[model samples]
Target: MRFPGFTGEWKETTAAETCSEFKSGKGLKAENILSEGLYPVYGGNGLRGYTSTFNHDGFFVLIGRQGALCGNINIAEGKSYITEHAIAVQANTENVTGFFQYLLLNMNLGQYSDQSAQPGLAVNKLLKLRINLPSKEEQQKIATMLSLLDARIATQNNIITTVC
Candidate 1:
């Protein structure tokens, strides 16, 4: 991000400045998934596969690393796996909010995008990304505000569909 109105410039930061670690998910074969269960399986993109086993149980951002849906970030539920080629960033409570970190990632991803015709995200490049952040309180408020907007949009869409 660049400074607006002033000649001063925004700073560049390493990914470590904002979090504790960037960890990848577990490897599970698809045949293991029970027909219906309580675990989430994430692959190069969103929930590409399924499983009955879980690796982590908490709020975290799953950053897709190398595939068709690479740059996209998905929020995981109580229990899940990251899979190969995807890195999960578990927020470091003191510096970043879990939802807010996901928002920031969703907001600004172009810089790390390979910009290929296929447009795949780079793990090495993503892990080094430094984001300009707002204060924790501000981040919380933004998350709340956006969440409201999302809820309202969902309601509105439901109303429209009902009418249709």
Candidate 2:
């Protein structure tokens, strides 16, 4: 469960312990999203559109709170506005990297989602979900590796688009 060169067992902790804040986003309607706005507006499925104002600043992990994609994870950096369909996980960078936390969340959140008429992720239940925290260095290493892979994937996708 850890990368090479890293020793010691990872510590068990709840999501709430690592995250400094967890709250559902403020209500933002589809009509409010502007195409030529200053800030990106995030919903359950990621960037829905743009807006003129923002409610959150800095880096945070956004988890989809409802719908079939409940438990989906996305990262919001700098100034952005999150809507009611997602919950933000704001972790202190000193302890955990936002990207690493996002990967961990996406890997384990599916089981916590309620599969009722409308699929949903309850914040209280999500906060209690267990997580294994690795050393900061290990986290950085893993995140860097994943980010590099993501960049490669994006490049391939762009090349495919251009060829088509």
Candidate 3:
């Protein structure tokens, strides 16, 4: 399946090629997570809480790197702290981060997690995984479309919450 007016085959590439960085975040103890603060804290499963400090600024794609939720993905932007349980990904300038987020969501990376006392995803493993890539222009279009749909969904949820 593909969008209209966009034609051409997507190139096959490795995750490593599409991304410039796949490093784990610094460890922030559970007690450090505050109810509310200046920066949002991101962990394996997503936003854990907030804290006074931030380790990363700007946009990033975070992958849950450990525990039952290994391989789960989340998007973070602005001032945010990514904990040790999440690997912060920086997509290459040639690719759109939003498009990679949706692509990873569809990939179901959980299946790649290693079975252990606590399942985990290794950065090296993710780097070796195969992926398909389209032109930068096409990627932007796809990301824009998905982002709009997501906004609509969020709005609908708010409406439902208000009514019910």
Which ranges of candidate 3 are over 4 A from the true structure? none
lDDT of 3 by residue, 62-83 (tens): 9999998788889899999999
TM-scores for candidates 1 onward, in order: 0.75, 0.89, 0.94
- The residue ranges of model 2 lying beyond 4 angstroms of the native Cα positions read 1-4, 105-108
Error of 3 at 123 (Å): 0.8
Ranking by lDDT: 3, 2, 1
Kindly report which residue pairs in candidate 3 clash with one another: none
Which residue pairs does candidate 1 place in steric collision? none
Clashing pairs in 2: none
Tell me the TM-score of model 2: 0.89
- TM-score-based ranking, best first? 3, 2, 1
What RMSD, rounded to one decimal, does every model reach?
4.8, 1.9, 1.3
- lDDT per residue for candidate 2 within 16-60, as digits (tens), equals 787777879999877889887899999888998899999999887
Score candidate 3 by lDDT: 0.90
lDDT of 1 by residue, 12-66 (tens): 5666666665667767777765456667677757776567678877777777776
